[model samples]
Target: MKSLSLIVLLSMVFSCNTSAQKKDDQLQNKTAFKVTKTDAEWKAQLTDDQYQVLRKAATERPFSSPLNNNHSKGTYVCAACKTPLYKSEHKFDSGTGWPSFDRVIEGNVAFSTDTTIGYMRNEEHCATCGGHLGHVFDDGPRATTGKRHCINGDALEFVPAKS
Candidate 1:
């Protein structure tokens, strides 16, 4: 019947649209936010683990980074471009095995749609180098910004504040 044919055509069109959307949902960062370096240069500059997490959008193991336990007063900068991202005052213990902060330095971090694990999440990136930092969540200190910037310690380097 003509009605059945119309239904089949509509289904095909919708299916194609869905497939295209899925393909576009990948968390790959193709746009360079600021710092742009060759792959070889990045490999030469960063450690193996740091390269993996920052460039490949991978997460480090829980409790693997010493920064998680660091309580020193200092600023945390991006591993790739050394852009100041978070302060020691915003750091807190979320028991998530990563360096967590109440908020990020405004406009110093970028966000993108991440669907690598088949679920959509707002993935954080270094505004300077476009490196993967981590995800931000709404569950955080009620007294502060109430936003949790769960960052990978390997993606950050701490600089102790001078007395």
Candidate 2:
């Protein structure tokens, strides 16, 4: 009876450890390695609207973005990581609810294939911080390479260069 009880206790301990490890693995796989801060820290740093759009992948209304009317020459950096992702010259009026950029700052962003919406879309994010910016579509105006990167304005912060 003593040996049987010991075996049962050991099995329970092993099972608990396995369950904890599995939970850790699931969390690590869901989030990319570039994010260094905790969830609580991110929530504290970003506004509720900003967090909803940037971290939760929420989309803003069309023409409602503050960056839509921004015509100044500068660079747009990630609000979470400060990684410069777009140049002011590459921005144009897509009339989409979000800010549209024709091109990205060289090596500032990375592409991922997202199929969550039942369609294949090119998802864009900060290369340095893994923050979700938005999607890039092939349909765009003639001024660019025929690519429209429809990004969330809340995901970025514009810094105008000194003239």
* lDDT of each residue in 1-163, candidate 1, tens digit only: 9999999999998777554354334325434456788889999999999999999988999999999999999999999889999999999999899999998889898777777899987788888888899999899899998989899999999999999
Off by over 4 Å in 2: 1-35
Alpha-carbon shift of residue 81 in model 2 (angstroms):
1.3
lDDT (tens digit, per residue) of candidate 2 on 74-162? 99999998888999989998877688998898788877666678998887877776677899999987765899999998999999998
Weakest lDDT window of 10 consecutive positions for candidate 1: 22-31
The C-alpha TM-scores of every prediction are 0.84, 0.77
Cα lDDT, model 1, residue 10: 95
lDDT of 2: 0.81
Model 1, stretches more than 4 Å misplaced? 1-30
Q: Which structure among the candidates has the greatest TM-score?
A: 1
